[model samples]
Target: MSEGSSSLPLVAIVGPTGSGKSELALQLAERFGGEAVNADSMQFYRGMDIGTAKLPEAERRGIPHHLMDFLGVREDTTVAAFQHMARTAIADIRSRGRLPILVGGSGLYNRAAIDVLEFPGTDPAVRAALEHELELRGLPVLMARLQDVDPVSAERIGDAKRVVRALEVFELTGRPFSSFMPERQYVVPTIQIGLNGDRAELHGRLAARVHGMVDAGLMDEVASLIPEGLREGRTARKALGYEQFLRVLDGESTVARASEETIVATRQFARRQITWFRADPRVQWLDWSQAGLGGAAEALVANSGVAGA
Candidate 1:
């Protein structure tokens, strides 16, 4: 896209987990007539609630939210698919004369919205073969292969799940995964707001959040999903809190241990998110504890020059 073409005003609220991105997005959307769009991968699935830290409708405070809880636990939703959906949602929101606020901590999703990464087209046969390999050799072997074939992508997509996806694209398209990434200059015009705070404070907040989820019946939510046939579903099985809670349900770990493990894993994930967003120069870092939502919203509006804000 040309500089003029890419200059459309879009607001993106992003950060690591427990950074208070959601609350800030809600406040900004309400104040500026914007719609909150989900950029979190886990929050897309239904019944994966407490583990995803999904914002409930009540918590939305009457501001419109797009792309939350629309898919089943068993469904396979890829980042490319999310990008297509997000493009449509953003266009629709802009068409209706409202701002589009891309929100959450998913770096890939944020990158897709702001950059021109073209996803390799899917092939069922190739996907089946990759899935078979995943089932047989497991994720470590596949991840190792990815590191050999496409080290940049291997570094970017470090986890087992993301490694599988990168390999699937490589196998299907016969192209290096890094080739699909658009050039830096091709990034879309967006006001990127990054929320962050002191690391120790954020960790304490994350632990508290995990405990709060437990108090709010996180285990019961997982238990309910198991009976509804989500016991083997990928979405339910891999979610942070739900996965650990499943271990507790299976009597492999006590609730206390599960909570502790979940908190640790979540903290690690947040650190990864922070690393990813920090590497991107487009984001304008903001300390949520230092500034209120109103101040952040005003700054974003002024910087982006979005009309009617």
Candidate 2:
């Protein structure tokens, strides 16, 4: 938790799933000497390319990207762990006198990298009781309690595993989970650039993107990962495209059906991402379709009040 050098500004490109944040980051990095640090949780897993929409090496345009394609599918990654690693990467990039361009749609991941948010440690004794409560009073009761205490987090989190963990953090920290998420206070000097455009247009783009992923061998990707214990990993098993294709492998659906489901799931995820980023007032939104978008962003970063960019 050492203070990051303020001489180098941290630039983050964030927005909905199909908002072209990744491409924009690449453009900005090329324009302003910077290295991209992956904040997309799914892209961290190796061999998860087609489904995660991970850019290939040739497409990276020779720019350095860190925290990407390193972990095995069966390995689990925690937010605290990712925060530590991302901060380390950012520090390293800054020390080398280059700007760190953090790119991803994962709200918590991006926040962990640049914001002053802290992750509470688990209390096994408290966690066990919450799990027992989840088993006894059912998810609704636990969710209601969390809603009463941390509605922001309750609204943000959907799956039971996360809900239970949120409640645990509340109990262990003796504070509302939402209270931990104060307004946009940067842990490092930063410029948060958000990319977005027409909703219907984005929906169409996401649908087409999903179909393209399937054509790029997503089904084969899932089938190949089954032996890698992808199904055994709590987080990896639930990734948008991978989860749907996993259903196809389980004989519960067809490739066409799975493809459609993946599109819908990705679209919904995009909506949630939009909501999450919209809550942060500090974000400077840029139209993804703007002409000379890269040049505009580069100018903004280079001329901004932050001492160094």
Candidate 3:
């Protein structure tokens, strides 16, 4: 844990979607001789470009980005698996004498990369039973059952899979899922820089971004992925734009309606993201619109007094 192990602190850039997190990460990476380790879960899928807002290679300015576009559309990943992948990428970046700039709006994924978090083991029989119940009784029924046992986890978890997982954990270990929530402690030397702005302005930015993606052929991107098994993907099929576009492919919805639905869902997701990052007291916040924003963020990293810096 000594010597070069502590050479540079892991730098994490976190914020809501459309808050310019990716741009800020690139700036700090370029200024500090760093490479990026992505924490955005959706960006892990290989062809989810325009919808996920994955920075194209030409726009990356030749800086290497890890842990993105490494998964097929039909594949899924757990936070535990992503934690290992992210930490390995960080170590690899550091070993090459480059700081690891961890970037994205996926709060839990980011925390798993740098925080002192541990995942609970799963039980096959318990999982199989819970999944059977999910299939028979539906998600809302399972969610209701989880709320009775672990209300805190119920409040924080929304999706069907996570709700089932929370219940599974409670059953397997006799512990509330929220009891395992990670503290603000870091597993390694790390700093978090958060970007934020006025809510109204962000809403407009997000709406426009969604429209831009639509004009940039998001439908085509979704169409192309169908042949590659987008519908079969548990995680990828549920992504914001991809889900809506899938409806369009099924002729169950119109493009305009799908686009509107995607915008609304993205906004809701962004609100959740904001709430998640704001709960972390260690994050140093900067306005996304701040003048000399890059300099301000760079100063925070430079003055952090971590070994190599």
Candidate 4:
């Protein structure tokens, strides 16, 4: 690493769900006197603990955590908002002479925290107009339009949510969504670590975790959110565990059926996350079970040229 690169150190722990990322990140924070920051989108909402698998205050092991449970479910917190918050958190942690450890499974959030991705400023009117169009014309129509204007971006963001985002940019700026995004160098030198395991083992773990969540009153959690007027909130309505529970609540499915559906959805999400992270060339992939916490921490520090505390 160059001298300039050596000064700004950020470590990121990324992986599919139930891959032990949170445990590894907490251990690293304890070992290096680091502060933990949430990079998972779902974890940003307050009162979304069990479903998001958030670490409780007691389980935080006395280390300070940033950006988790800081926003309400109804609030519109975008990637730009997260970038701003994470930058401030990182600066604050560094000022206190502590390392910043970003931990979560959200690949986009992880990239925003490390790379200097330019986000177009939020405009509610623009978002509302685009969302109206999406509701009218459907995602396929918007995706077709994106393909015509910016095939690269359309390919990169080939999802309903992303198609809406692209349309929002186009409506807001009268420019192709891709035009505003420039290739960026990392603003903070980062050690990006990805956790992996045998595909069968990962699937097994995911199923077990989903079952555990159900056993731990995931249905009650969803019921509480609904009565709090979160039934229409984008964050709460679409959360992995909460969505399936909603189905159960509506009598559309049995509890067993909901659990099965949740596991399937989570597995699909994990597959997408793996695909996204694998495409990023900067991440160093390792099997979490094989490397263990200590080895992974050492590897991250050594790769980033960050001396051990």
The local distance difference test score of each candidate is 0.81, 0.86, 0.90, 0.81
Residue pairs in clash, model 1: none
lDDT of 1 at 212: 96
lDDT of 2 by residue, 1-309 (tens): 113444778899999988888888888777767789999999999888889999898999989999998798899778889999999999898887777999999989899899887887878798778879887889899889989989988878876678888999888877877777767789888999999899989999999999999998999998888898899877788898898889888899999999999999998899989998998988999888889888777777877644343
Each candidate structure's count of clashing pairs = 0, 0, 0, 0
lDDT of 3 by residue, 244-278 (tens): 99999899999999999999999999999998899
Q: Against the true structure, whose TM-score is highest?
A: 3
Q: Give the winner by lDDT.
A: 3
Weakest lDDT window of 10 consecutive positions for candidate 1: 1-10
- Which is the winner by lDDT between candidate 2 and candidate 3? 3
| Clash list (residue pairs), candidate 4 | none
Per-residue lDDT, model 1, residue 125, is 80
Candidate 1 per-residue C-alpha lDDT over 236-273 given as tens digits, one digit per residue, 9 for 90 to 100: 57888888998899999989999999999999999999
Candidate 3, position 137, lDDT: 89
Tell me which residue pairs clash in candidate 3. none
Compute each candidate's TM-score over C-alphas. Answer: 0.92, 0.92, 0.95, 0.91
